[model samples]
Structure formats: C-alpha cells, structure tokens
Target: MRAIIIDDEPHCISSLKYDINLFCPEVEVIDACHNGHEGISSIKKNDPDLVFLDIEMPAMNGLQMLDQLGGNIPFQLVFTTAYDKFAAQAFRLSAVDYLLKPIDTHDLMDAVSRVKLRLNRDVSRQFDNLKYNFGRPFAEQRVAFPHRDGYDFVNVKDIAYCRADGAYTTVTMADGKSTLLSKSLGEVTEMLPVKLFERIHHSTLVNIQFITQFIKRDGGYVVMGDGVKLAVSRSKKDRILSLLGLERW
Candidate 1:
C-alpha cells in the first residue's frame, strides 16, 4: 500500500519510516510530512492507499485536517499519538488503527495488516456511530468488540459480566448472549468505565447493576440476573462488599 507519514517530530517520522521499511515491506512510504497541512496536500496529491497521521501537530491538527475532508475520505487512516488521550478520539473517527509511540515493530506491522483488511470494508458507519456517541452522555456511550465475522457494539448497561479466557475475554450480556473478544481482560477492563464495572476476581469483571445476590458460599460468590454464579477471590471480597454497600462478614 502506498502511504504517507505525518508527524511534527523529525525522529518519530524517521523511526516510523525505518520500521515500515524493515518490518512492513508491504506498505510503501510515498511521502513524509512535518505537519497536518502538508499531510492534507500530500494525501490529495498522491491519493495514497493509507496514511500514518500524527494527532498532535502545530498549525493544523490531524483531526482538523480530517474534518476538512468533508467526511468523504478516500484513503484509510492510522493515527500515531504519543499521549493516550487521543486514542478514544481516534477510535471515534473510525481510524483504521492507532499506534502509540514509540511504536513497537510488532504493533506497527499489526496496524498495517488491519488497515489492509479494513480497506475493503466500509468504515463510515463506525465513524457515524462515534459521532453520535460523542454527543451522548458517558453512560449512554457504547463499546465495540470484534466478534465472529465483524464487531458487536453494546451499551455499557447491557453487559452482565466479563470473564478472562487467557488472552481473550468472554463478554456476557444481560439478555443471556455471550461474545468472545480478541482482547485480554486487562486490556478490555481499561476501556470500560471504572465506576460501572468492578473486578470481583482476577479473571472477572462484573457490572455492578447485574448482581442479583451475593451468596456467602465457597468463601463468597455473586449471582447474576441470568443465574451465572461467579466466585469472588478472597483478596477482592472486601472490596466487592464495599462496592455493594454491604458489611464485611
């Protein structure tokens, strides 16, 4: 894929270019721009297949440049940001991928691979969903997870619990449906709102609202509305009790 690298930092541009050439030989660097304006011009001029854009740039930011595109972007975008604050925004924009800097070689390759796969798919819906979410309150926001053929988007309140399955997570919904995610429990936990989801076990994260009853059996366990019993680790018992507003036995 023909691509452009846009970043204000010289070393970052150099490093990404070197990494792309060494690791992702499938992606060709067509142009490297120092700021967003140059990135826009390069993209329009070259009509590249992909673009590696930086979020924080002077004169015009990456999002600003994208906004100028009038939502009919022809090429895929992969955002590079040093700070994690922009990750949510990148996801909101339906970016093909997000690379945290100093970008790892494996991550860079993985991002490129995802970009290639998504190139054939329509990503405009995700962008529209994100735009809708931005206007809603945080509690009304939704989270998307990669499922069987595509992705499953669920409201935070609809999730009953999440269980760790080694490197993957099984998300159980209140309606009794479950979906396996390709992300680890730890990784997925970070994406969830802390106030709504609580870790009752090392491998389990439960939505506080779905707890039907807390049974003091096998040390301690919580019963979900769907009747799934989940054990509470001894270390987490007190914390869970505190969250439940119950007295510790």
Candidate 2:
C-alpha cells in the first residue's frame, strides 16, 4: 500500500519511515510532508492509499485539513500525535488508525492491517462526525447520530434532552424531532460537554440551555423550552438547580 507521512518533526517522520521499512514492509513511503498545507498538496498529487497525519500543526491541523476536503475523505487516515486526548476525536472520525508519538512497530503493523481489511468500507459518516466536533470547544461541539440511510449532525445547542431506553437513547432535538441512537446512555454521555449537558435522572440527560423552568413539584422536574417536563433524580436535583443559577439555601 502506498502511504505518505505528514509531521512537523523531522525525527518522527524519519522514525515512521524506518518502522514502515522494517515492520510494515507492505506499505511504501511515497512522500513525507512537514505541515498540513504540504500534506494537502501532496495528497492531491500522489493520491496515495493511506496518509499518516499529525494532529497539531502550525497553520492547518490534521482535522482542519480533512475539513477542507469538503466531503468524502479521499484516503484512509492514520493519525500520529503526541496527545492521547486526540484519540477520541480520531476514532470519531472513523480514522483507520491512531499512533502516538514514538510510534510502536507492532501497533503500526496492526493499524495497517486493519486499514487493509477496511479499505472498501464507507468512512464518510465518521468524517461527518469529525467535521462537526473536531477542534471545537465543548459549547460548539455537535453530535452525530446514525439514522436509517445516513447520519444526523446536530449542534449541541439544538438538543433539548436525551432519554435512555435499555441500550438505546432517544435524542430529542429543539425542532421537536427525535432520533434513536443504538449506543447506551453512558457511552453517549461522554460525548456531550458536561457543562452544557447534565444528567438529571439515571436515564435522562438534558441540555441546560434548553431548560426554561425548574419546578419544585414532586421531588422536582425541569421544564424544557418545548414544554417537556423531565424528572430530575433526587441526587442530581441540587446540582441541576445550581447549574441553572438557582441555588437552594
């Protein structure tokens, strides 16, 4: 498989090439780029089968460069980064692989092997998810939910509340539409910003911005902008109230 490496650190680029030659002999190093801009231009020129990308760059980061592609990622991406925090975002983008700095030979081979197996699968959905959330602050992040045919990208601000049912969670949007996600509530909870979303009940998480009223009736329930009443668990009632700027003395 043809591949290119995009990293600002010259030593890392050289090390990756060495590892590929020794361990991942199936992959050929086509071009080594120093920045995202060069990576973009080289990608357009080489049209390689895989790209070893770096997350943090001077002008355009890896995600930013992918965003500029408009739609449909042209090649498989294996992100090489120093930060472990970027792993979540990388997987959300359906990246073929992620390797931290001081790339491991065994891990490199394993990632490449996975890439070879999934070269034909459609990763556009993953890209859509990345385009919405990558590099953005929690307040600006969006969530991707798989629907019947494609995926739904909803801004965090547009989410009213999330209801958990068994392994699935129903996400109610501000527009009165709800979508069912196959993921468990606990899994989805991690994707949302804690400051913007608060878990009120064991099965309910609500967007604090969408909450319009806090009723002190029957233990307590919060009224959303759409007039939907969500019951708040006793444990979370005080915290939820405090989050809404209503402190109980």
Candidate 3:
C-alpha cells in the first residue's frame, strides 16, 4: 500500500519509515511531511492508501488538520505519537487505529495488517460515506465520554444531541448528562450511522428511540425521554418526522 508520513520530528518519521520497510515490507512510503500544512498538501497530491500522522505539530494539530480537510480524508490514518494515553479513547470512538511512538515492530505489523484487511474489505464503504458528506455541512463526527478517570468512550448511541460550544461539541446524553466531545457536530453526524441518527438541527442529533414528543414550532422540536428540548432544522424536519413515523401528523 502507498503511504505518507506526517510528523514534525524527523527522527520519529525516520524510525517509522525504517520499521515499515523492514517489517511492513508491503507498505510503500511515497512521501513524508513535517507539519499539518505540508501533510495536507502531500495527502492531496499523492492520494496514498495510508497516512502515518502525528497529533502535535506546528500551525495545525492533527485533529484540526483533519477537520480542515473536511471529509474524504483520502487515506486511512494510523496516528503516531509519543502520547497515547490522551487519544486512546478518541481513536476508539472513530474506530481508527494508532501506534505509540518509540515504535514497536510487532505492534506496527499488527496495525499494518489491520489496515490491509480494511482496505481489502470495508474501505470502499467508509470512503464513500466520508466523500459524500465532504464539507457540505457541520455535524457531530465523534464523541469522547469519560471512561475510567482519564479515558473516554465514543458512545454514539447514548448521544441524544450535540450543541456547539465554540470549537467543542457538547454531547447531551439520554441520561441528561452532557460532555464535551472534540469534534464538530457536522463531522460527527457524517461519521455516525445515518440510519440510526438524524441531524434535526445544526446542533442536535435526536436519537429516534429517546424522542418522547415532537412539538411543531417555528420549525420543529423534539422532547427527549430525559425532557431536554432539541430544535429541528427546517431542512431536516421531514426526514426526522419520517424516521419517527410522525410524518402523517
């Protein structure tokens, strides 16, 4: 598979390259970039099958750069970082794989094998979904809920709605508690299973199961089981109504 390496640290990139060549012999390293800007350009230019990305870099961090790219990320990503503790939950939520720095040859091989399997099987489906929603709108793309102290879970189901709090999306759960997830609402909505969740408004995703009542207002609103009122955008009202089997009303 063709691949690109993106990291500010030259040694980190070099080590990864060596490991890929030595252990992951099937992976071809087409290019490498020093920062997020260069990484974006390289990805757009090469359109490689995979990307080895670093989380912290100059100008734009990995997550921000991914956001800027909108969707259709062009390749599968295996994030390489020294700090894995903070991002483990986020990675799990997105269902993306990652490798910790001071790289392990065995773990690298495992990650590469997983990538190859995905490419051979499910990559097309994932790519199509991401491409279809590239930059047209903003929706919750992922979630990170506190797990055990410092860890978190994506919890796509428990999320009833998400509100934009500047750069963060406040994910409101069915239980009435809220947590700040690091992705935008638009991105989250696109990444999530569309049949299961609908973006009723710019800031909300009302879980069809948790919706207790639908109130007709300026546009529409849903009263979730937990009694939280969430607004439904005019454009999405029909879809939400249809999903809830309330279209006849």
lDDT of each: 0.81, 0.80, 0.70
TM-score of each: 0.77, 0.71, 0.51
* Candidate 2, pairs of clashing residues: none
Q: Which ranges in model 2 have alpha carbons more than 4 Å from their true place?
A: 14-31, 37-46, 59-72, 81-118, 121-137
- Candidate 3, residue 228: CA error in Å? 27
RMSD of candidate 2 to the truth, in angstroms, is: 4.5
For residues 79-136, what per-residue lDDT tens digits would candidate 2 score against the true structure? 8888765445434433335787778888899999988976755666666666566567
Off by over 4 Å in 3: 84-86, 120-249
lDDT of 2 at 154: 71
Worst 10 residues of 3 by lDDT: 129-138
Better of 2 and 3 by lDDT: 2
lDDT tens digits, residue span 109-214, model 1: 8889888887856555555555555545546777767666666667877888999999999999999998888889997887777778999999999999999899
Which has the greatest TM-score? 1
Model 2 reaches what TM-score against the true structure?
0.71
